[model samples]
Target: MTNDSSRASGNQVSWQKRLQDNFDKYIRLVLTLANNSSQASGNEITWQKRLQYKFDNFMSKGGMSVFLALVSVFITAFAVMTTARYVVERFFPNGPTKGTDDLLWEIFVQLIGLRDTGDEANFAAKFVGVITIFMGLVLFSSLVAFITQQFESRLELLRKGKSLVVEENHTLILGFGDRVVDIIKELVLANESESDAVVVILADKDKEEMDDFLRNNIAELKTTRVVTRNGPIANLSNLDKVGVKVAKSIIILNDSKSSDNEQFKTLSDARVVKGILAVVAANGEENLPPIIVELHSEQYRRLAQNIAPGAVTTLNEADILARILVQTSRSVGLARVYLNLVGFEGNEFYFYRSKSGWNNITFGQLPFHLLQAVPLGIRHGDGTLTLKTNKDYKLSKDDEAIVLAGDDSTIEFFPEPVVQHNRIGCVERNQTLELETENYLIIGWNSKTAIALEEYAKSVVKDSQVNLAVEVLTDEIKAEFENIAKAYPHIKMEVMQVNMDSLDQLKTLKPYKFNSISILAGSGENAEEIDAKTLTILLELRQFFKEYSAATKTKVTTNLIAEIIDSQNTDLVIKAGVKDFLLTNQFVSKILAQVSQEPDVMSIYEDLFSLDGSELYIKPIWLYFPANQIGKLTFADCILAAQNRDEVCIGVRISSQAQIKNKNFGIYLAPTLDKDFILTVYDALITLADDQN
Candidate 1:
């Protein structure tokens, strides 16, 4: 039992020694790791306190190592000294043999001298080892720092460039169309004060095509910044890459897909809307803004609205065609006049209440002699605004007045002594001269024809005449025309199978050199072939008109307007010298975007174009002024002129040479300081009161 107890004690001592050794090794390993990691982390390094911690660890482990090495060296020296002393005693216990004593003392003195030189060498070697170890640590640490900083620098660059990655307040406009240039032009006008306003366009087209278009056509966009990214709109990931969540608004363009017209529009717009909604949902509404959508059918409008409430949505084909029908039926230059009022280019619509002396005055009394500004119309609370109300219709205090030139700031004062106009001056006029009868010819037929015919009927007077020539006339459409033909016997309609491509056959109509012609899109399988055929027909028609006019010795005004379904193909027709080309595709998409935001805007527009007391007109502001004396008037002064004449000034068109300040890029509105007040033959459109009649 005693032997067993002793063995157990010995084992316990050995285990204790092993545990101490392990603890020491672990401390050393931890110190090494801490020092290496701290230096290698670079910018990610901890504070100075962590460095102090590492230094403390280094001192602990290093001191222990130095102490152990010193102990081993001391032990070796002590053992050697004892052995030398023992050998001396063994040879001569009492004293060194008398003869050997001298020899032993000499040897001992020589060894002592050698030991001093060895100690010097040992000190030098230890000093060199310490410096080498420190340098290796520094060199390794510095290499890690350089590699880490390089990686961090690249990350910093990426973070900085993320702003350019398309984010909030940036607008995304898709598709390429004839109206895109105009739409962008208006956006630049709208966002003039912003420093970093961005308009990014995503199109499945060559970047060069868009670049060339802007370079050649848009000179008005002087300083506007627009970026273009090329890709298909069908891909959700591609849309995400453009940074949809950061966008202020997304305008999904109609007619940018390859499929059936209605199906393609609905599908493509749906896809865009879905992608935007997904991103917005993931980003959260509090973070992501809204998107404006476009649709081809009235049926799809409801779906779009459901998907994104308050988003702009419209049936482009129907609304545009309806407007064309309404406006064209009015008169020539009427559409241009209407454009000034409703469009962003000219003067925008505004409301103000008449103050003081201007209060309670009839439309007739607010002319230039009394009020300093022109009174165009009034907008009511129910979203009804008239361009020109009746003359005797006295304006109340609550009435929202629409002015031609001035807004709320400049239209504050009313001149003293209300100016009155002579009633006799309003009536006594010479008999209206008889207008010469003119003939108009229309070619081609489609759904657009219905609107075109309605417009044509309204533009011409009852005394004027027109002839419609069509190929492939339908029985049902012909039946509808019978009722229209009954209303006007002079509107002769004839159908024939003659080919428009054949010049000889087209010459048979002899539509007079100066007659107007409109070419509408028709059913065709091959777009390129149809374009080629259409081009041939138009050239032949022009040639025939030129030769026939010269031979007949009759000069007539010929205006050609082409309706292109695809905006991308509009350039070909525009270059063909067509005076006016309307890309319905683009027009409809824009209308959707606008009405989606403010549906009542369309109502205001409709009222502007109506034939009631408020109607759009292009009466020269110069017509009402005295001979050659109207100075370069302020926007306030221009409004005064309208107020005096019972008219509304919507916009002003100046010559290319006119110099203006604070003008937006591609801006066609706002009069210049140096332009002559003399009314040019080419006039601008404003709203007029029927009371002037």
Candidate 2:
């Protein structure tokens, strides 16, 4: 019995020693992982283990990562405490008060140390309890410190942004708003030519949430690496996180959401101005990278330029969109022309050094030399973009010809003569004098609706009429419309409040009489309702046009245009035989996308769209090409004829049902400079010329 007792005691002692060794090793392991960034030696570093190594490395780094490190420490301490108590109870069964696992509770509850409840064996409990109590206190204290530091680190990170970025020549996009996805997509396309491209986004949004949103929107981003930081982008201190100094370019978008109130919008614009100031200040005198900002008002845009001399290219996105809407409203294919000019997929503008053979040649003779490219303007050595310069204006040796070509590589001197290649026909030109009282009808209300109306008002003659009929709108929108009306006293403005869906209301307002009808995607609480309303109005208008044509026994040629929300729904409109529709919001996205790719492209658009310069026009084919002519007239013939008229003929738009897909919304841009096609009576020449020209 004595031998058995000795053996049992020896067994208990052996097991206790083993448990102590394991507990000590566990403590060492936990502390090693918490303190070290590398994996323990002799351990298999699987992908998971490698991930842990990376995670620990990240935690060791400065910024929010430090919080995770402290969290690791806290978790390790808790694990150590739990394991220690469990080991002590299992091995020291006799040393405890009873079979119940209550010693751990006592270790936690005990203030000073541990004591035994039973009087028979208080010594054993004292010896075992002292060491356990001390271990728990040390671990608990360390854990408390870790918890405190962890939260402190997190709060500090939230107050500031993440760590300073190390990227060089990266595009910095400030202010994440409605066009964020579109901007990113454009940047991605811009970077397609490069092997490695980086785009950093700094916005007043959660970084993780931004990441999730991007991932959701862009299922798979190709070569470009996108990084996001959470903080107020306009804040000067937060700007450093995006490495503004090394940025290739910085784009500041309007931050105000569509749902934001008028007061909030003003604040958002103020933030944009402040953000531009911050960027300029951050990079003092180091030749500040090209900064692009979108402000609402011309007053603010001019102010922004004054604030940052030669550094800011202020764009009024809403106003520019308003102009495009107005232009496209009257000209059927103007939207597609703008889209082609801005997108990277097709022909883009490139600045080319004038070839030696074409030296001292007149601008009129420029198109004959390069068969593939169409010269848009002369970008002088000093970078002055002169669009639609005088035909007699001679090209200087230092002139950089602005030629529209397929791509940068595709730009070269084509030796082939640019002549017409296809059989063509000519039709009688319908020549007329000044337009008779343009009656414009707008259906729906957007923030840009008033701007569109104001733009439209500028083109019409005195005593022209404008009718606005919207289903629903805010007081602010109405006030803006009224304000615009006051500016144009000659143009009679009329507002009709009625449900557009009601056929009787639609009948009361005869849309057929109007020279132009602009049906913007109707405003609604949701996109579905907006699209539904637009479709309904579109269908209703089609029915009215059909009926009006049948009753009058005359062809109704009222110019029709509609704004669509989704590009996919364009098919529905196409099926309805209403060929002209535009994605207005998407247009902004696409233009921003194009500009983000090549900043110089912005100059091309600026010149094309500016009111004081040459603009796109859908002039009749006979205006340049004489009527009663047979056989195909080549692009060269069109170019020479347009040059005579102080215009540049880029493409032709023919009324053909068979060539819908090939046509860019009824306009074709940069069709092989030599390619020729038959011209019909309804065909129009897409020209870039001043209105007076």
* Candidate whose lDDT is highest: 2
All candidates: CA RMSD (Å):
17.1, 18.3
| Deviation in Å, model 1, residue 94 alpha carbon | 48
Model 2: lDDT equals 0.71
TM per prediction = 0.56, 0.71
Cα-based lDDT at residue 365, candidate 1: 46
**Cα lDDT for residue 325, model 2?**
74
**Maximum-TM-score candidate:** 2
Candidate 2 residue pairs that clash: 424-631, 424-632
* Model 1 residue 205 CA deviation in Å: 7.7
